[model samples]
Target: MSFNVGLSGLNAANTALNVTGNNIANSATTGFKSSRAEFGDVYANSLFLGSAKNGVGSGVTTEQISQQFNQGTITNTGASLDMAINGNGFFMTSDNGARVYTRAGAFGTDKSGNIVDANNNQLMGYGVDTDGKVVQGVLIPLKVDTSALAPKPSDSLSETMNLNSSAVAPSVTPFDAKDTNTYNYSFSTDIYDSQGNSHSLSQYFVKDNTNQWTMYATVDGVNPHDPTSTVPYTATLNFSSAGVLGTTSVGTPTVGAGFTQAANGKFTLTDWVPAAKNAAGVMAANGSAPADGGLVMNMTATTSYNTSSAVTAKDQNGYATGSLTTLSIDGEGNMFGTYSNGKSKTIGQVVLANFANVQGLTPNGNTGWRESASSGVPVVGAPQSGTMGTLNAGALEESNVDLTAELVNLIKAQSNYQANAKTISTQSTIMQTIIQMT
Candidate 1:
């Protein structure tokens, strides 16, 4: 009986050392939760021996208890592909139909643009529609549709160009068909075609007279509104002293791939003019110009006058040529891409999901987990909402392992194991002495 007790002690010590070794080995493992060995003394007893003052004590038994999931330090590593769970939750992923959960947020877009975890498991999330909005109560696996991802032109063009409001328009000289050239202002940028092919588009604003200007534009190698296909596209921009759209404008003929412009000389100065007014007020039809009267012109056309057929928007056939710029993502996951044409459009938004019992999830390795019967259905939601953590773009969350704490625990477990080993040795010595005496 004494030898059996000593043997049990030895077994317990061995198990404790093994547990410590496991902790040390996984100290650097990402999303790894250190575990402690649970021990309980066994009592040898029976109803028939209940009257005994003390029953024989059996050695310790080893059990791996639940792991501690306290929050880990969230170090921000500037990686857009990195994600971190700040609170009580794990990222849900699915391998084929096998669901798993994890705290590792290192994610990236696969060749198909589907968000995949390190193990190639698809990150589960609600799908966002074309409008970049997630429908309620519908939880589907999320995947980025790379094939369908394409840049689209903007539907409308908005511009605020500032010119010397007091500048005089040039007189109509046959040699200078566009008298507005006196002002001599030109700006150019690249605009995309229907196929997203870029083309250089330029606009020159020339002062024609006191309040009129002729705008000339060139697209690709051809002029969109040339009179004989030999001249550049030209339009008149007229403005009253008060910067109001004047009645003098030209009706352009349909030309170009997806745009039309008025014939070079046919566009009148007043047709596309906008109301001209200084900061003060509009100028009167009478010769009385407001003290701050200036040349301000704004014009919009029902038809695209500059864009190529290749530059159509997603839901529309054509967009204004002036609708191109850069792209950006906001905290709300809204993706905005700008075009060289000075236009920006919402491209798409990111999606996130949540689970009711993240702790109840079963680990499936590779920093991932699977949904078990213990874990309730996942509750889907966007990031930074309710219990969900805010998303930090271009940043990744580092591993949550506390090296110091793990080391300390390792020391404690080792000491405990050593003490148990000593007890076993002492017990063995005593049993040997008893046997020798017998």
Candidate 2:
């Protein structure tokens, strides 16, 4: 009976040492959780069911090994795609046709633009729809849009400028872009066409009176109305005594058109005729008119004051084709992609999952776990939603294992082993003495 007890104690001690050693080995591992070995007292029955004083308790036996799911330390790695959970939930990933959950966020993208972990298991998430909204359904591998962006035609433009009131009117009658004497001040901006082609939009301002100014607009130095005629699109500006603009009158492009004009006399361009650039970098007139409507220019804030002439703000809603430049993930797990054209779009969102009995989950490899019957069904959701946690981009979670605690446990295990060995040695000595006396 002593031999059996001593052997069981040695086995239990060895198990403890293995558990502690495992924890120490993974101390520096990312997203690693520590584990503990548990044991129960053993009291096996004899072959004949003998009772009373003959009963004896056996040594300890292995009961269960549990994992500790505590929050790990966060370290910023400066990796854009690297992410960490701040509150709760695990990053749900998919293996070869198998679902896996992990806290490990060391991830990279494959050649196919799919986001994956070190083991090449694809990270699952919700993709965005055309409207940039998250599409909730069965999870799929998140793929980034790395293709070149499409161009958008100029739709609206706004400019706020202050015209000099003390300036004298230009002597030139017919406005000509090549002659600087025809206009007082000129401003230019780049606008995109239907084919993503860029064209220079120049506006020349000529003071007519104390409160009146004329603006001559041109594209690539050519009049958009008629190529044969050098006269650019014209507009008249009238200012009030307080320097605020009062009325704006644009030259009628067509004799009969359905363009809507505002009560404030703001100019509206409905149908724009496309133009091309010549070898000399001048915008040459194209014979075909663009099917898309023309560009709308707003100058409701134009002012004629005694101060120096200056343009306060200029903004246009048009951009040429661009390529993907960078990516970012928000706390809500929304993945955003930026293009060279200065436009941003939401592409995907990270998916997170949680379990009712986290302790009951089966520890799978890759710092991940598998769902088991003991662990209730997974509750899947987007990050920061419900009981799920928010995400931290550009960082990773360190292992929660404490080296000091494991070292102390190692000492205890070694001592237990030595004591059990001593017991067995004493039993051997007593048996030898009994034999010698007999």
Most accurate candidate by lDDT: 2
TM-score of 1: 0.65
Q: Estimate the TM-score of every prediction.
A: 0.65, 0.87
lDDT of 2 by residue, 1-438 (tens): 489899999999999999999999999999999999999988866566656246678888989888999899999998879999987889888898788899999888999999999989888999877788889876878988799887888878888888898888889866778888988999898887776777788889999888988887776666654444555677788889888888776666543132334535356656445355689977676554332657777888778889888899999988888899999999988899999988988989999999999999999987999899999999999888899988999999999999999999999999999999988998899999999999
Candidate 2 residue 145 C-alpha distance from true site, Å: 1.8
lDDT by residue for model 1 over 273-315, one digit each (tens)? 1123355774212222111211112243212122221222212
The true-structure Cα RMSD of candidate 1 reads 12.1
lDDT of 1: 0.53
lDDT, candidate 1, at 436:
100
- Please report the candidate that would top TM-score against the real structure: 2
